[model samples]
Target chain A: TAGITQAPTSQILAAGRSMTLRCTQDMRHNAMYWYRQDLGLGLRLIHYSNTAGTTGKGEVPDGYSVSRANTDDFPLTLASAVPSQTSVYFCASSVLLAGEQFFGPGTRLTVL
Target chain B: SQQGEEDPQALSIQEGENATMNCSYKTSINNLQWYRQNSGRGLVHLILIRSNEREKHSGRLRVTLDTSKKSSSLLITASRAADTASYFCATDQYSGGGADGLTFGKGTHLIIQP
Candidate 1:
C-alpha cells in the first residue's frame, strides 16, 4: 500500500498563478488535512475534511481552498499564489478526527 | 499565532546521551502527539499521550503528559545520529470534530552528533 501519495513533488510558479496540490491516501481514513510548513512557523493547517464530502477551513485558510470529493483524495488549490504561499505543503489522513495521522512526503512550492 | 510552544528552539547532543524536548500548549486538549521530521521529509508520528494518561513508552521513546500544566515532554534514550531531526508537538484543542485541525509548535531542532 502506498499509504499516502502527493503529486508535483516540487514546483515553481509565478505570482498570481493557479495551482493544485494533489493528495491521495489508500488508508481509507475518515479525516484528511492540508498543512503548510514554513521556516520557524512550523506547520499550520489550511483546510480539513471530517469525512468524504465535508470540508472545513483551518487556521490559515485565507489563500487556499480544498475539496474532498471522495475518501481517497483531498486536493488543495491556490487560485492566486503569493510569495508567502511558497512553502512545503503536506497532506495527512487519520482514521478519526484528532487521532494519530499518516502524512504524505510533501510538495515543495516556490512562488517568485 | 501557534498554540504550542516547544522550549529550546534548538538542541545538540552527543551520541549515547539522552535528548529531552519539552512542549507547552495553551488551553485544554483531548490528546497530544509528538512527530519527528527528517530533513526534507514529512513529519512522522512518534508517540501520542492522552490527557488522562501521564506517561507512555514506545521502544526507545518515552513521552510524559501533564494536563494540569498543559505540558508534555519527549525523551529519546541512547540517542543516535539517526535521531538528528526537528521534533514537533501537536495537539487537538478539541476532540472529535473541531474545524481547527491539529496545532503544531515551532518545533525543537535536535542534532545528535556521532
Candidate 2:
C-alpha cells in the first residue's frame, strides 16, 4: 500500500505566487499533518487535522492554511508564496493522535 | 518552539563501531520517538518509547528513556554505511488528554565510514 503520497515531487515558484501541496494517505488515518523542514530549524508543524472536516493551527501556522475535507486527504495552501517559505514540506499521517506517523516522500519547494 | 534538542549535531565513526546519540526534552511527554531521514528524503519512524517505559530494544537499535530527567539516548550497535542518516527525536507532549502534535529536534547527522 502507498502509505502516503505527495504531489509535485519538487516545484519552483515565483514570489507572490500561490501554490498548494497535496498529500494523500491510503492508510485511512485519522490524523494528518503538514510540516516544513528548514536547514537548522528542524521540522516545524504548519497545521494539523485530527479528523475529517476539522483543522487546527500548529506551532508555525501564520502563512499557511490546511483543509481536511476527508479522512484520506489533507492539503496545505500558501495564499501568496514568499522566499522564506522555500523549504522542504512533508506530509504525514498517523492512525491516532499520538501514534507513529508515516511520512510521504516529501515535496521540495523553492520560491524565487 | 522545539521541544527537544539532540546532543552532538554531527557524528562520524567507522563501520563495526557502536554509535550513541542523546536527546533532551523540555516538557512532560506521553511518548518519545526516533526517526531517521536519508539525504533528500522524508523521515522514517524507527522506534517509540512511552513515558512509563525506561528501555526498549529492536534489532541492532537500543533506546533508553529517563522520565525523571526528561532525556533519552539511542544506541546503534555494529553500525554500517547503510545506517548513515540524520536521526531525530520527537516528543509527544502531554496535553491533558487531548490531540497534540509531536515536536522534533534539529537532529544528529550520523556518518559511517566504510
Best by TM-score: 2
Chain A of candidate 2 compared with the true chain A, TM-score: 0.98
Q: Assess candidate 1 and give its lDDT.
A: 0.93
* True-structure lDDT of candidate 2: 0.94
Candidate 1: Cα lDDT at A59: 88
lDDT of 2 by residue, B13-82 (tens): 9999999999999988989999999999999999999999999999999999999999999999999999
> Candidate 2 DockQ score?
0.87
Looking at model 1 chain A, report the run of 10 residues with the lowest lDDT sum.
A94-103
The fnat of each candidate, in order, is 0.77, 0.86
TM-score of 2: 0.98
Clashing pairs in 2: none
Each model's DockQ score: 0.78, 0.87
Off by over 4 Å in 1: B95-99
A1-112 per-residue lDDT for model 2 (tens digits): 8889999899999999999999999998999999999999999988988889988877899889999999999999999999999999999999887689999999999999
